[model samples]
Target: MGVDIGLEKFLATSDGVLVKPPQFFKTLQGKLKSLQRRLSRKQKRSKNYEKQRLKVARLHHKIDNRRKDFHFKQAHALCDAGDLVFMEDLDYRVSAKGMFGKHLLDAAFGQFRTIVKYVCWKRGKFFAEVDARGTSQKCPECGGEVKKDLSVRIHDCPHCGYKTDRDVADGQNIRNRGIKLMSTVGQTGMETACADELPGVGLTLPRQVSQPRKGKTRKPKK
Candidate 1:
């Protein structure tokens, strides 16, 4: 499984499934502001004031709990299904400094990453983090380039004529890259063992045999 973290939606998987973002904080912001205003009008240090103050705190706690519950459910579901899970090691600090800083913070990408890593570890599934730099910009189908900015939600690849939701393309790229890395590792291990068992077999390397494909994902290379 490859997970591409996003601000709009919580996650988009390589398989084209999307996990809709639960905008807990954004949804409750107005109510919180109203509670704060109400609390401000109450006499300072009085019983009524204390009660209103606790109400505000409780709202905050509720938001936190809901966000956490969503994360855990997502992480558990992903970890339970995939044999290997990969994601980009995105820097939330940098993301949080940009125009959508508040939105990103409310989404809490860091918290989700931690939960996913632990859940995968606890479930005995392989977990890997790859460089996120070009995953979003590359076309997963044809290994072609597709330049896009943050505002571009749909990816129209000029090179391969491929089209997809941007986050899904990113997730697909991450999964492809992870599989390539694992192939390299597996080949390295096999070369050593095969060389010892059979002398001449080490000279020629076999191609990366792929299964017969029916999906658009694994198009034959151009």
Candidate 2:
């Protein structure tokens, strides 16, 4: 399942390897410092000044490309290996603000999903977006809700007494949502409901196909 990176509680308890996200800022900061030195030495608007400016811009361009490449590779690796992916669908506009905002935005959680989605589509896999609003606070076992401040790392569910690594709970909650969703569609026995959503709760099987095909007409009886 897809889990948002940065939720330390979930990652710590998760069953897989944790690779620290690459730092593009470190690379950009170095490029900017060098550019500043060159700009300081050049006369404003002069031909040489413009050339140096373009060089700096080119470096920035390359750095951006590299950052995207890394994110895609990591995200693709996660998405490709799993039959289904569950990840937080964060409100980037609101969540990505302030000092760490740019860094968080740079993580481009949204972009990661987009890339993962296209790849999943190509491979006939399933991709699901878990709502982030209460995922971190809800108990996976008994649907208990807990109010927690950001500093509270442990997910202590008062109602159900279910305790877990917060991120793991969120991940499990995400997985549970996928299960509930399948149940809902399956209950109705409506092919449309189950057709697109990820299928086979927790098994990572692709969603069942529904709806009749088009583009070819049946011939009259011989």
Scored by lDDT, model 2 comes in at 0.69
Which lDDT tens digits does candidate 1 get at residues 138-196?
99999988888889999899987888899999999999988988999999999877775
How would you encode candidate 2's per-residue C-alpha lDDT over 102-190 as one tens digit per residue? Answer: 66665666666677777778777777776667877778788877878778867888887888666666667777786677678678887
Candidate 1 lDDT score at position 83: 87
lDDT score of model 1?
0.89
In order, candidate lDDTs are: 0.89, 0.69
- Looking at model 2, residue 171 earns an lDDT score of 69
Choose the strongest candidate by TM-score: 1
Assess the local accuracy of residue 92 in candidate 2 as a C-alpha lDDT between 0 and 100. Answer: 63
In candidate 1, stretches whose alpha carbon ends up further than 4 angstroms from where it belongs are: 191-222
Any residue pairs clashing in model 1, and if so which? none
**Deviation in angstroms for 17 in model 2?**
5.1
